[model samples]
Target: MFMVYVSETQPLVDFLRSIKNGSTVLMASYDEPATKLSEEARNLIAEMGSTYVKSLGFRDNWVFVGAKALPVKLCLFQHIKNNDKTNVYENWPEIIDMDGCIPKHME
Candidate 1:
């Protein structure tokens, strides 16, 4: 699953084009004027299909605006990290140190 935030159509199209078929995408943006699309964006997304649709309300800052969308076959784990680490990151039940790096399995 991929999470993306976009303001225009071409970038969204590029994002869709980059992903393989059967991939799932999660898209979010500030609620537009109830008429956000400029006809072209709507058409582009329509051609893309509902398998890639996910509209959301406004967020203070978009965390990942241009990352490649993820494949649907794999499960995805994603969350917004708190800008200030005085508290825990939003996705965590346990605490994460601000400057800690653990070894990855691939490494």
Candidate 2:
């Protein structure tokens, strides 16, 4: 498992593409993850099993678990908190916490 705080798109996209099959990826948002995020990056992450990647917006809190080249059913864990425009908190959404076990990948 690897943890990443997305701030840039190219580096993250490159890293996501380079990962080997079955590799687990953990992602968390910090500051503004969408300012520099590209459509390609969002599509790639969505393909990797993130349902919320496409809707991720500015200052939204997001956490996701995914795996390279794996079935979506095997790696589908995510949590998202959209920034509340009417009642903003510290210019960002509330933080999220998640805990679970990812089944070991078999060859």
Candidate 3:
């Protein structure tokens, strides 16, 4: 299991690319995840089974759990919109929590 707080796109993309197949990855956003996010990074995350990555916006709260090189059914994620009406704080969405068991990788 790996936990990450996405702040920079390059490091995140490199990290995502380096993980072995069947490795579990968990990611969340801090202040502003998309400010410096790149298309490659978004595509990478989307390929990891994130349905919301392409639409992720500034200050949106996001959390994702996925298994590298695994099927999409092995992924779980959620995001909270940071728009004016949905934000809990100025320019930020409300915090979110997620919990589940990921199937262990078997050789």
Candidate 4:
């Protein structure tokens, strides 16, 4: 598998839908100001995520959408042609290897 990081999902939806099974995508990283989000905006974002995920359906393909925090914007995409899939967390050792910061969730 290989990876791609995107800030917005709409632009990559087409390309993502065309990828073979066992692929993974990382999107919508939550940053420092995430705490400033209003409850209404959070609800809207959540709804949008569900819609985006449903639009791109591949049985074995996986997509990780997040409002989670990362060292930067939380985005990672894994490209797998056949069945060579790996745990999403395993893809980035640096997250675990960091001095004090541990990523709570991938998405």
Highest lDDT scorer: 3
Alpha-carbon TM-score of each model against the true structure: 0.30, 0.79, 0.82, 0.22
Consecutive 10-residue window with the lowest summed lDDT within model 2: 1-10
**Top candidate when judged by TM-score against the true structure:** 3
Q: How far in Å is the alpha carbon of 6 misplaced in model 2? A: 11
lDDT (Cα, tens digit) per residue for candidate 3, span 16-101 = 78988877878888776676778898888777778888887778889998767775446788788888986788777788988877
What are the per-model C-alpha RMSD values against the true structure?
Answer: 10.4, 3.6, 3.4, 16.4
Off by over 4 Å in 2: 1-8, 76-78, 85-88
Q: Ten consecutive residues with minimal summed lDDT in candidate 1?
A: 56-65
lDDT of 4 by residue, 23-88 (tens): 232333221113333344334333333233333222223334433223344333322211225434
Candidate 1's TM-score: 0.30
Evaluate all candidate structures by whole-model CA lDDT and list the values in order: 0.34, 0.71, 0.76, 0.32
Predicted candidate 3, C-alpha RMSD = 3.4
Instruction: Please identify model 1 stretches exceeding 4 Å from their true place.
Output: 1-8, 47-107
Q: Return whichever of 2 and 4 wins on TM-score.
A: 2
The sequence of per-residue lDDT tens digits that candidate 1 reaches over residues 8-104 is 5566556566766444434333323113344454444434343222331223221111222323222222223223443243522223223223222
Over all chains combined, what TM-score does candidate 4 have? Answer: 0.22
Better of 1 and 4 by TM-score: 1
